[model samples]
Target: MDELEFRRQLYTNPRNRSEALLQEARRNNKNKKLYDDMQQLENKLEQALNVEVPDGLAERLMLRQSFDDSRQQYRRKSRWQIAIAASIAFALGLSTSLFHWQQQAADMGQLALQHVYEEMPYTSGVDEQPSLQTINAKLARYGASFEQLPGKVVYVNHCAYAGSPALHMVMKGKMGSNINVFVVPKSTELKTVQSFSDKTLHGMVEPLANASLVVVGEMKEPIEKTLHTLTAELNQAI
Candidate 1:
């Protein structure tokens, strides 16, 4: 298959392990790389979409609805008493089930990896290295500012992350590799983790007082060093 046809088939169904497509990919290094990248993206997308609902989510929702009904029927009860019960129920639901749901929905590492692949079609020709001032222009929206980056920047853009605006950046890594860094406001639903990884990439999440930094790099890249440098150099507006 030609490049266009190969890409078409690969994206349409990355799991198509037919011999014909496999042979085509094996014959062309570029096609093989593209095939692997698309498959990894598909896997991550599947993982993000297939999260199991908490064991008692429906029961909690029912309980919440029941609480609402009770409030309507017990008008004579002290307002504070009814309110307290409702609050307790809501908190219990969130603490047990909704919180897990949120964590799955806002899996920052998976989201970041997906974003990188989604932008792959456009990132190749990106040649501009944004200045620090230019980069901070976007970061300012999240109450964040970077004192300096650990390496040369290759790309920068604004993106939506976990239902909030985020600043996405790509920097140069060892041997001309690409490392992605995302600056997201603390207000966003995404809670940062210490580290995360997928088939082709791995990185760390640094949670600041008012914002979070998610740094992603190829599996072979020195991501920990970059994260250390970034945590030390990154400044947040208190």
Candidate 2:
């Protein structure tokens, strides 16, 4: 199976022991790592959800019944305590891991690269050829619009950016290359990055008055021209 299909299947059931998935995971180290992470998260959630009654609660209640003025009240309070404890355990376990993951993606450049990788399976192909008007409509909510697109738009959607909504677009580039452009609202805490790259992709960030524009493409593909074109075409819609 392809990367996208494998990811979908694995997400459907992280503990899947299908031969196809195991083979794919064996073939690709990245896939194996992702599978492991998903499994860990699944285990944590299961452990959190598996709330068990404290030992000797029945005996303790029986003991208290002899002298307790209001047995009913005491039982209710015990139930509430147990419920609260379970909720706290679940929240602590979940939030800790999620916060750590978010911190790892705190860098604007790293976040952009990570987003590109996640969406590449879908965005690499020409799934949709949206009009400039359609693209601008999506951008309008982000306080920006395009007068003329830099290139042919193949895919466009709104995706998460640091827990906020951001515009994601895939445009056709020179020599059959695909370029990813992200428009994120300006944030006080997250400063814009000049540029960033990995083994497979490289990109630059352009900070605007109302938003930061990130342009990403393959390692060797020339993205500076596309960046300039987009910078010129972008008009403040607010």
Candidate 3:
């Protein structure tokens, strides 16, 4: 047989013509080498393709052809079943991962808000009436160097900022406006300004030399003026 017919016989049905050809070649001494070379080439091709020429596979194919029945129905059914099962498993895994991510995000948000509320100065009892001298003295240690702006210093205490001890003072401004100042020594004053507002009060921040000053009050204009004057005084002291 020609090369194409020989290959087709080996792939389509190896049991029938392949063995018969080998037996015929062995009977004919002239074709014995050709038959041995063909067998070796076929073995090499099978190894390269990683396909085992099962003895039963060719028998089953011939039997099915003779019976005229569909032989690949079971394989097609198995493939479809495996595909559907894989899709369902992937969807379930994806949903579980998304749910876990969302839960972690919500927990992180609550933790962040709680930490921020704890660090805020307005939430503490620092506004209660305290000794003014003690407060000013503590502020002086943090480089406040105050000249006592015309007001009754009613509240004085040290507050924590970013794990460092800072000064917090509440002095009665003109017209019953309370001036709350926060001083941090290690932080350098920058030109940036920011505002914060709670339900009951509003506050502004300003930079001072080697420190940051924040004043929380109800009126904006008076607080701004006080912050500007305090910033100038604190800068001169440094």
Candidate 4:
């Protein structure tokens, strides 16, 4: 098998043990890496598909079977029904996993941008507006600190992002709009400058070693320039 054939087999049935495909994959460096990555995904899918069986489930299922002719007919249908239930469960699990994985891959920056406005309703609380000391204190937990902000700090609060605890804040921007900054610690972020936008909000995510610094503001605002200056100040403080 050539590289394409080997890859086709890997994609379709990564567990295949055909010597020809396996030999070709091992011999080609590129094919080996592709095979490994695909295999890892396949393994994850397999693990996700696995369902835990209740204790004595097999015994309970067998107990429902009997040898009578009329009962045997029903028994056959029961077995078929059980198989269908298992298949449906497996299909649902796979679909849910795939949905979340696909969502996480598509437009992470856009999600950060949306989060800013989504939390606006709760902005009126007395403690919602926090001081610079409070902001840097939260940052210091993730091995980062800011002696000064690019603009006036208008709001600061500890919020949740992607099901994890994160530091959420807002700063005054040049265009009379508040910039939302969500800092998430011990979370995954893109290791590059990723920009995202919507009709009302625009944002970027800067991946850091211990946290992700996400910034969002109005679409017409100077995002790149402001982010650069803010990041520089943050680095200096650190």
Best by TM-score: 2
Q: Can you tell me which runs of candidate 1 are displaced by over 4 Å?
A: 1-103
lDDT of candidate 1 over 1-238, digit per residue (tens): 5554466567667899888889889987888898899988988988875654454344333333334446555443334345555567657876889776676757777778877776666565565778889888887877777787557888887766765667888888775778888887776556456888888888888887777788988888998888888878777777
CA-lDDT, candidates in order: 0.74, 0.82, 0.54, 0.68
Q: Which regions in candidate 3 have their CA more than 4 angstroms from the true location?
A: 1-133, 175-177, 188-192, 219-221, 232-237
| Tens digit of per-residue lDDT, candidate 4, span 57-173 | 444444555555686686566666666666676789879998876576445575576566666654423234566688788777667777676677767766656555677777777
The candidate, 2 or 4, that scores higher on TM-score is: 2
| Candidate number achieving the greatest lDDT relative to the actual structure | 2
Scored by lDDT, model 4 comes in at 0.68
Report the Cα lDDT for candidate 3: 0.54
Please state the error at residue 15 of candidate 2 in Å: 18
Model 4 misplacement above 4 A: 1-72, 75-83, 86-94, 105-107, 124-129, 186-193, 236-238
lDDT of 2 by residue, 68-106 (tens): 557688768768766666567669988999888867667
**Candidate 3 per-residue lDDT over residues 66-104, each given as its tens digit:** 333365875554455555555566689879998765554
Best-to-worst ranking by TM-score: 2, 4, 1, 3
